[model samples]
Target: MELVSLIIMVLGLAALVGIYVISRVSRQHSPQKRDENIPVLRDADGNELSSVCDDVAARDGKRPSANARDMSDVMMSNVSGKSKGVHQPIADAVALPPQLVLFIAADIEAGFSGEEVLRALDNAGLSFGDMDIFHRFVLSAQGETSLFSVANGVKPWTLVPEELVMQTTPGLSMILNLPSQIDDGDAINDFLLTAERLTADLNGILKDHNQQPITPALRAGLLAMAA
Candidate 1:
């Protein structure tokens, strides 16, 4: 029994020694590395340790590419709540009746309602000019309307940047004629902003007056005015 116990202890110690020998050999064979089993390079005198990652890695990690940075900057600029007050287009402002007529004509041609046109205009903050008039009034069966038709005959609603396709209906519904006393000389800052204010002009009148709720498309359009 004494011999058996001694043998067991000696075997345990021998196993421990073998493990230690293996660990030491492994450490010696594979030196300490930063990561990925790749060793850090030592400068002369071993003071400065250079990593596997180079200056390119540092740059890629820190700064975006020029185009990416520009796009990011522009996008950030768009929604940064900058006040673009009442930016009317340089075109001659047309009268409300003519504008209404044009809107009606465009809607009729597009198989949409006057309401949709009005809402889009409000969202776009667009106004009427000769081109605007022409587009709204003179399209054939499958044609687009002018920016003026989209805006509800409001002055200074003319800062609509071009390229807004005369979409059929607003995906979102908004109240165009919310009871706000806006003047002719109202400094719009941004038409869409005014439109949102107009849309919010509701207590009971909105449910009673507007049948359709504002569509997401129109909401997107209004937000797009900032862009």
Candidate 2:
């Protein structure tokens, strides 16, 4: 009886140990898929996560892993063109406590720069937002499409070189100045509506300026942002 009990206990512990190891290995190996096309990362709690690519790295050996995003160290990545890739929500990923930071981005067509954004915010009388919001919008254009004539016709938004940021995802967005931080429901609604208006205006400029037909996905994104 005693021997049988000991064997059962050992097997139970072994199973637990195996499960733990598997979980650890999973996190180390699986890259986080970027889902929200909204640009920046907000916690499941709706708070803005630091989108700065502080620790994006591919594994050196057979078992690949990401560069750690601790404040002390920084790394770079070829995939995200930065330090780390995203990891999906873990078990602890619950709706954050009381308040979370919101991420608002300006499309490639909109004039979203530090100075212009500041000018807009100041002109708009908005505050509490920062560079994280305004400066790092990832811009994507049809590389095949030439905008030389369009460039002459209408100047697309430009950011300072250092301010030009990339994302782990395939798309583009801007992280503007954190001059006005809006939290949750109302803030998100206002932000979305405003973004739509900006895109509608940009689409007009693209049509008249470059005689470009905005792609379906781009138009969809614009409409979603507006909605």
Candidate 3:
């Protein structure tokens, strides 16, 4: 009887140890939880428009701009067909130019050097053109159509190399107006790729329209808009 009791106790202890080991391993491999306090921008239908990551917020030390909030409201109204008294079809809604905006910002302590900014812009295939800003063009059936445009973040936004030399800017704003002559999806893809390249070249943070760090979720949402 004593021997049997000892065997039962050992088996129970082994089971508990096995369970503990499994739990620890599972936790170690589990995905990290997102911070609940991070702000999320959603449309009228509760579809997430964009979100600010905690790490980005900490790094930027800034909140989303009022313009971003206003844009979100405008998008929601467009999506819900509330822009006009009558319900508008999604196809018709997409016909209107939906502006996709992104930002490349330098570190808070220092602004981008004029030489570096000009070099980055040139490398990204932007040419100084209309509005005294830089424009990215793509060839389509209609000939060269504007894919996107880049402007200095500072007042009187222009990207002329000579003008850039006069003043350092904290960032640049890249805007893509959709429903151009080219395919929207292709245009969006090119726009994002160019923005990413410019961001890398300038060593700047790539932020969404809301001026928040671009996360995978935000990227997907932006792509969906083009679709």
Candidate 4:
């Protein structure tokens, strides 16, 4: 009886060992599973890094290329607020006041007296109160009709150097300071006739501030002052 029980115990032990061997062989012959320790790549901003290639390559200790590094640098610069963009400049705007001015330059011979201009204005039935040297001449008209003047040129009151003083000589030109006080074509016609007659008497050529001949174009523009 004891011998039979020992044989049974041996057979049971061998069977357990055989089962353990089969399990070990099956495990060894089966596919091996690699342990992957993927790193969550992120900037200092705590964003997760992803993508199969980047994650796998990073685990394998492989780095990106030069262009990739440059792109990363640009992205980092933008994230860090170190990048810049194209900028533009602004310009100033200026406005001019609603003041109308007209000029009638003249061509007088040398040695022409300024007093002759004064006489021409007087003959037009114009009167004066004060003489502003810078404004050169100002003649008052009847009933707020208009105030006019005949000066060397436009803004004749401007002081010139002795070398440039020839520009201010009488008979060189005359500027008629005509303010748009009358809104009638007859008034403009009368003013033009008076200026024309005076300029004819002085033997001066009638021109604009630019010394361009006063054509019908100029006359039509001046007519708007009366309107």
Candidate 4 residue-wise lDDT at 7: 100
lDDT of 1: 0.30
Candidate structures ordered by TM-score, highest first: 3, 4, 2, 1
Q: Give the residue spans of candidate 4 off by over 4 A.
A: 1-111, 131-146, 154-168, 172-179, 184-187, 220-227
Judging by TM-score against the true structure, name the best candidate.
3
User: What TM-score quantifies how close candidate 4 is to the native fold?
Assistant: 0.37
Residue 35, candidate 2: alpha-carbon lDDT: 29
Candidate 2 lDDT, 69-105, residue by residue in tens = 2111111111122214343321122221111112233
Which structure among the candidates has the greatest lDDT? 3
Residue 99 of model 2, lDDT score: 15
lDDT of 2: 0.30
Worst 10 residues of 1 by lDDT: 96-105
Measured against the true structure, the TM-scores of the candidates, in listed sequence, are 0.19, 0.22, 0.57, 0.37
Give the per-residue lDDT of model 3 (tens digit) for 33-136.
43312234454555543222111221124333322334444345454454255345535654433456677877543567788888998898888877777888
Model 1: per-residue Cα lDDT at residue 102: 9
Regions of candidate 1 where Cα sits further than 4 Å from its true position: 1-72, 75-112, 119-127, 133-188, 195-227
Q: What lDDT score belongs to each candidate, Candidate 1 first?
A: 0.30, 0.30, 0.64, 0.39
Candidate 3 global CA lDDT score: 0.64
Candidate 2: clashing residue pairs, number: 34
List ranges where model 3 is wrong by over 4 Å: 1-97, 225-227
